[model samples]
Structures are given as C-alpha cells and as structure tokens.
Target: MTTWDLAVVGCGPAGSATAMGALRVDPTLRVVLLDRAEFPRDKACGDGIAPQVVDLLEDAGVRGVVDGHVPVPRLRLDRGAFGVDRTMARPAWVIPRTVFDQRLVEAAQAAGATLRRHRVRELAQPSSVVLDGEVEARTVVGADGAYSTVRRALGLMPGPMAVALRGYAPTPANRANAQVIAFGTAGQPAYAWSFDRGDGLANVGYGELLGHRHDRPTKAQLRERLDVLLPGASDGGTGWKGHQLPLSSGRWRPPTGRILLAGDAAGLVNPMTGEGIYYAVATGFAAGRAAAEALIAGAPASAGARYARATRRLLAGHLRHVAAAAGLSRHHRVIDAGLRASAADQRVFDDLVELGLARGRITPTMARGLARELAGAARRRPVRRRR
Candidate 1:
C-alpha cells in the first residue's frame, strides 16, 4: 500500500545504475532495488567492461567499478586467413559480473536507494506499478535482463536472441593484453571471443544471433563451436555458463505505460557484437533520471515516453545504423572486408569499437574504406587459421 517513487527490478548493473541515476538527480526520491539473488553472485557474460561503462558509472556516482581489474588495450579481429590487430581507442577492463554487479548494488545503496532481496514474480500497473501486489511504485524500471518478467507484463516480446557460452581460463601467453575475436565465416552464425581479464585469466566464449534464419545452439553445440572457433582456449576452463542475449534492433519502441525497460530487458544488446553492458548502464541511468524528473513533475506515467526520447537522443540514430550494419555483415566477405579495412586504418577500427561497445553509427569514411577493402579482398583467397 505504501508507494515508493521508483522501483527497479533486477539489481544487476542496469537496476543498480537506475537507482544511482535517480538518487543522483534528487537523492531524496524513495527508490528500491529488488533482485532474486544476493550480492557476489555469478552471471553468465563475456565480462568485457568497456570504458564507456566507466563513464556511465562515473556519471551515476559509482567510481572504481573496475578499478583493480586488468585492462586490455588492444583488439584483434580474425577470420579464416584475414585478421587485424589494432589498439583500442580506449582500454577495456575485464571484470566478472560477480564483482561488478555487487559493487554497483552497494554503490546504489550507498546513494540512499534501498536494497531488497525479493524476487519480483509478477508486475501489474493499473494506475501505479505494482510488483507481486506487494511492492508499489509510481514508476517502474524493468532492468531484469533478457526474457524479463516485467517486460512480459508490459505486453511485449523480446527481440532476437543470441546465446553464448562463457568461462574463464588461464590467459594465453600470446594474448596478454588484447581482446581477441575470431569471426565466423561470412554469412554464418559463428563468432568467438577471448578477452584477457589482466589477472592471468581470459574470459572466453562463442555466440551467434538467433531467429535470423538459424536455430539456437544447445550447450554442447555452443561448446563445440567454441572449440572450432577458438581451439585450445576452452581447455581447463572453469565455471562454464550459458546465457541468452536479446539483440537490439531498430524495431524497439518504448512502452506506453509507467514501466520503462532498460538493459537486456529492452533488447539493447548490440546486434553487431552482443555487447549489452554499455547500453544497459546508459539506458538504465537515462530511465532513472527520466523517472525522477517525471515524479518531480507529478506525471510519473510519462516516464516511459520520456525515457524513450532520452535514449533516442542519447543513441542518436545508432540503433538503426547498427541494425543495418548487422544486416550487411550477413553477406559474404563483409566481415573479411571489415577486418581488412580496420587493419589498414586506425580510424576504421576505432569506429568499429564505438559501434559495438557504445552508441556509434556508420560513417561515410568507414563506408568508403569498407568498399575499398571489399573490392581488394575479392581478388585474394582467405588464409586458413591454425586450430
């Protein structure tokens, strides 16, 4: 019966970041974070934390999120015989979600948001948002990740899904400070990553987009794909886990009610790279800020639309651009050409990183470069990589 200003489900990065964003704005707004699990819990993820996430955390008043983690400054993209090794525009930290999520939750609590270890089984909004008929809030943020329960309550289906298997192992000697990506053959559903966590371990995984004319792979098949794509990397790996990512597409529209979806719940994962942390933090923060403003204005129901506009302005045509890029990448030789172009130019590589990890769009310069590389790549045979 007691209503709070904001209630966020799922106290992961997205939910905690939402609380931080709201409290950072007003600090007095009654915000509650509800989650099914306790702190220091494991999450299935590639565990690559982009510097852009650091920026968002800083804005949310949570610093040192990845402070002690090792940073990977270089990115290497490879395909059957074509490859590119380039320095990232900024370094990325590889921190397992267990540490990262807990820190964010603690930061949110420190910012005056209440944390409750309660699982939100159902959500209903007649006038005010209610969770399981126990928790009530003027506005709700569904940061519950892929296959979100709150999202289902909003009468929406999740977008396309990509499944990946992740585990950690001793860092390969040859890739000490680099995040390596092995692209699947063009037009095929295959890609694998080995990101150094800078602690002698590398987070390794393989994934593919689903519902784009491909069947979802089983766990055994996912591990098999990892073996084929990044051989010898998965050996002796520990704590192997599989999770689904809801890929972002331009088709996403905001809810028409007081509920706003953020993070994986909104399908904000980068279609091109399966990256969601950045989008999760950014959108969650945006939603929290928008919800705070709406509550302050005595129009909490307007939070969804306000959050939508805020994301549109924040993402700035990136959603459409990445959707198109992912489409083009399905064609033969597109990945090869992209790697070739990125290898030849730093600007292109930087652009690629921005597109995958943050809100970056296709650029004219990148287009010209890709076209040139495509033309050149056609004349040569792809070099086969050693398993």
Candidate 2:
C-alpha cells in the first residue's frame, strides 16, 4: 500500500531517462522503473546512437555512457547512380541496445530510482495512477516502445509504422569506419545501412515505411534486398531481428490525466530517418519533468496537460517540417536531389543531418537546394490555392 511519486513503465532509453528527469527535479521524490525484461537484453534496432543522445544523457547525469565505442564520423547515402559521402559535423556511435539500454537503466538506478522486474498489464487513474492495481503513483510515464500497453490503455490511435530488420556482421572493408545508407529500389523511404561498431563488426539493417506498395517484404526478401543493396555487407551476419517503428507523423496529445506517454509509445520516431533515441530521451525527460511539476504542485491529474504543452513546444514545428520533407521523399528524385545537394555543399550535408537527427527544421538553404528538383521530381503541376 505504498504510494509513489512517479511510476515509469518500460526501462528502455525513454523510461530510464524519465526516472532520471524526475529524480533530477526533486531527488527526494520516489520513482519506480519497471520493465518486463531484464537488463542487457537485445533489442532489434539499428543501434545508431546520435551524439545528441549522448548530450541528453549527460544532462541526465550519465556521462561517458558510450565510452570505448568508436566514433563514426562519416555518413554515406546512395541510390541508383547518385551518392554522397562526407564526414558529419558531429560524430555518432553505433552501440548495440544490449549495452546501451543497460547503462541508461543503471544510471537511473544510481540517480535514486528503483528498478523493478514486472510486466504492467493494466493502468488506472480512479484515484492516483495505479498499475495492475498493485503499484500506485501520483503520475505514470509510459515509455514501453511501439507496441505500447499504455497507449492502448488510453485508447489512442497508433501512428504510422515502418518495419526494419537488423543484424550484426563484420564490417566490409570499403564501408568500414562509416555509416552507409543505400536507398532501396523496392520503394521510397526504403534503405539498407551498415554502421561500423569499431570492433571489426558493423550493425546492418534495412527499413521501409508501411502502407506503401512495397510494404510486404518477407523476411527472406528483406535479407535478399540487403544483400543486393550492399554486396558483401551481410556476409557472415548473425542475430537478424526485425521490429516496427512508430513514426512521429503527427503530434501526440496526451489525455488530461496523470498518465503520459513518451518515446515510441508516443510515436516519437523521426519520420525522415527512423531515429528514435533522441526523441525518446527528449520526450521522456519532458514527461518526467512535467509529472514532477504536477506532483509538486499537488495537481497530479494535470500531468498529461503539462506533458502535452511541453512536447508541443519542443516537437510541433519540427514534426510539421519533417512531414513536409517526408512527403517530398516519396519520390526518388527528391532523394537524389538531397544527395547531390549534400555532396556539393557541406552546409547542406550538415543541415540534412541536423534535420534527420535532432529537433531541426528545414532551412532556406535546404529548400533552395532541393526545391527545383522536388518540383521536377514529381513532374506535376502545382495546385493553386482557392481565392
């Protein structure tokens, strides 16, 4: 019958960060972190950790979490005969989720949050937030990823999804020490990537948006496409696993109660590049802070409103811009234009990375570089707005 200040479901990046954020706000507040699985468990992901994610973890008081992992400074994008290879402004690390998630959970525990091994089957707000009628808290943050129980409990509509298959293999010599994305011919927004882990191996994967004509790639076909896209890249690969990405195609408005959703549960994955760690940590922290503020103000039911406002300020505009970008990306020529532009100007490359990785909006420079191609890419007449 112990009531807690906050209960966070899911001990992945988002959940751990949520606990850390709440504890940072008021170290004395009681926070419980729960996950169905144990630490060091493998998750099916590209495992590309943006440096921006590291910055956020540092803010959450976990520094050097990616220590000893090699920094991958170069990113390459290719489709058909067009390609762009360049060094990014900031380096990124490729660490398997097995190591990464465990470290974040440890940091949260170190920051005075309790970690529990329990599956949360139900949530109720009849009084304080209650999980499975046993664990009670003033507020709850849901960070349980794409197949989110909290989102289902709240009766929220699931967002758009992209499925990706991931595996580990020895780094191909030509693509070693780099992160390479090869746009697939099967469909728009489909690509295969090989990211060097700096230990003679690379994390390789292929992903494509669902609800498209090319959505139905069987497991063997997915692997076949990977082999064709990057020859020799998948050689001697192991542990191939696939997962769904809940894309942040639109804004997520939390209900007016003590429950809030973060990370993939909120559909916070980046639409342009399928990156979610940054969004996960950022929204998790915001949700945690919002819950903390509501709890401290003695208006726990207001947690959702506080979270909605915070995320609106943080993601609304960015989501809109990325939506526009994603629409244009439906055509392959647009992808070619982006690659060509990035090759010609380092500023364009930096801008594209920023837009894909962090809370970056489309810039005039980006628009100027790709606008004409975009118009011609579709080869369609513009619709005039009604007067």
Candidate 3:
C-alpha cells in the first residue's frame, strides 16, 4: 500500500476542505480523501450558506459553482408575536448540500488530492487507516460528522449534542428570497427554520438539543409551525429527514495519540444556531495546515497537540458564548423576551444575530441596552407588599 502524507476520512465540506488546504500549502504532499457516499449525494441540512462560508469556498477554488446558488439578502426572526426582518450586510446563499458538497469534492481533486469512495472501518496505530486494506499515512484527520466512526475509533465521547429534521416544500411566491427562523415555544429550547432555495423550493426544519428536559417537537408539530409561518407550506410532511449535530461545549479533549479530528467529528458545531459548515471549514483548514506542517517537520505526534491548540485559539471564546446561550435557552420565556427586545432595538438585533452567527462578540453598548431593558421590566412589575 502506498503511504500517503494525509488520509482524510469523509469528503463533506470538512474533509474536502482539509485536503484542499493541505495541498494548497504543499502540492507535493500526497493526500487521499475517502467517503462512503459518492458525489452529489444528498445530506440533510438547512442548506443555508453564510457569507463567511462563501469566502472559505472561494479560497478553496470553488467560487465559480456558487453562482448557481440562490442569493438570500434578508433574514427574518420570529418569536411569538414579536418578529424582526433585517437585510444582511453580506448576503448568504441557499444551495442544496448535494450540489454544494460535490463542488468541494471536485475542488479537492483539482488540488491534487485523490478521492476514494470507500467506507473506513478501522483505525490503526502510527497514523494508518484500514479500509479494504491497510493504508499507511503520516497523519490522519477525522472530518466525519456527528456520528463519526473516526471519533469513536479514537475513544472520544461527545458532550452535548442536537438532533435536527429538515425537508423541502414548494417555495411561496412572496418568500422567494427570504430566510426565516422561528424560536420554539416556552421550555423547548429549539427553533424552526425556513430557507427559500430560490428554485421554487424552501428548506424547512426544526432542531433541539438531545436529552433536553423539554419534550422534543414531533414532525407534525414542526409541520404545523411551518404552515403557520409560511402558510400552506410543509402541510403534509412530504420529505422530512433527520440528522445529528454535535455541539461544541468548550470542553473539547484532543484525540489520544496522533489522530487529529476536525469539523463535526470534533463536535465543532455552534450551539447557539446549530451552524456546522463554517466551523467545519475553519477547523478543517486548520487541521490540514497543522498536519502539513507536522509532516514536513517529521513530527506526527505533534500534530494532535498543534491542532488542539489551533482549535482552542480559534473557537474557545465563541464556544463559551454559545454554550452559555444554549444553557439560557432552556428558559424559553427569557429567549422570547430577548427576541422581543431585539425586535424593538436595531443595535440589539444586530448584536444578537452576530453573536448567534459567531460573526462578532457582544459589545459594551449592547450589554448596556440589555441591562436597561431588564431594569425597565423590573420597574413595570407591580410592587407586592408582605401580607
């Protein structure tokens, strides 16, 4: 078996991005990407790509394919009777995972990484992977998602996680270019979403943290909510599908030995919004760079440590905030109040959205606004004297 410099398991955004990032740094590095599914395979997702994701895709040499996506210039947030609609300064795009993932796979191949369609069954010592046979690699990256065989092979148990179900409905003529997110009812700690694919179809779904104390919404409940929000959309639950999201809780432990994990395999999804693509690409790039550097330096053992440090540096603060938000979301009434406040205050709305997207941090001004809002609510409460 030909020993390769890197073997990336899973060819989704993370795996492909790892291969592409590695080869871009050193074209001579031999990289092989393996996946059980072939290109153009559908994956259950929200199908919404943020602006930062576009930047990553462009850097990976897949910008041309993005033109096929539907431009989403506006975002709508709804919580009970309060709602806010705002135009994104940088527009996002809606594209099916089948189409989007294939482009990334093609880009990885174009970057000189070999693509193999095989299911990885086991992991061997000294950075080797076993499939139909043993293939030695100087380093290995686990980009496989939530139910990552690679992560389990490394004996890493994930912390808190989420389960999401999404399906497509015919897009309403009036909502062709808008994206909508609706917060779940009190105590649910989840949200439902609808993204207009601009191809006469809208992606609608709901997600909740696994093991949450509150009851998880059923497909029927999700359908009913979609009907209320989009009216006549998703009325019959035609094509609903479910997937797992391994949320980051800021307690990540690096995989034992030399194996490196990135993307969902490492539980890198944003807890606040269940967004995985951006983190996948970011961590995949970091893993690739770290692996390439370690391989060139003849220090495979250092790869895990280096990758861990890089991930901490990149995601520690964001993960902390997201974890906090996830915890607070358990009290849905607080979230509802926050949403109402956001609807009434533009700065509050931007800050809240930015934090949810991991685009920016909470500023002092936003904090002050929140404090004032809380104080006012307290004053409005009728004083009750001890009887």
Worst 10 residues of 3 by lDDT: 126-135
Whole-model Cα lDDT of every candidate shown, in order: 0.87, 0.88, 0.79
Candidate number with the higher lDDT (1 or 3) = 1
Which lDDT tens digits does candidate 1 get at residues 1-387?
A: 768999999998889889988888899999999999978799999888999899878865578888788778999888877799888889998899999998989999999999888888888767888899999999999999997999888778877788889989888887789999998874465699999988888999899876554566788888878878788888889889999998888756878557898999988899889999998999889989999989988999888888888987887589999999998888757887888888888999899899888888898878989999887876676778999
> Tens-digit lDDT track for model 3 on 115-143?
88878888777435454466678788999
Q: Which stretches of candidate 2 lie over 4 Å from their true place?
A: 212-216, 372-387
Q: So what's the TM-score on candidate 2?
A: 0.94
Ranking by TM-score: 1, 2, 3
Residue lDDT tens for model 2, 16-119: 99999888988999999989997879999989999889988887679878987989999999987779999999999999999999999999999999998999
Task: Output the better candidate (2/3) by TM-score.
Answer: 2
Runs in model 3 with CA error above 4 Å?
A: 126-132, 212-231, 382-387
Provide the TM-score for each candidate, comma-separated. Answer: 0.95, 0.94, 0.91
TM-score of 3: 0.91
Tell me model 3's lDDT, rounded to 2 decimals.
0.79
Task: Candidate 3: give the clashing pairs.
Answer: none
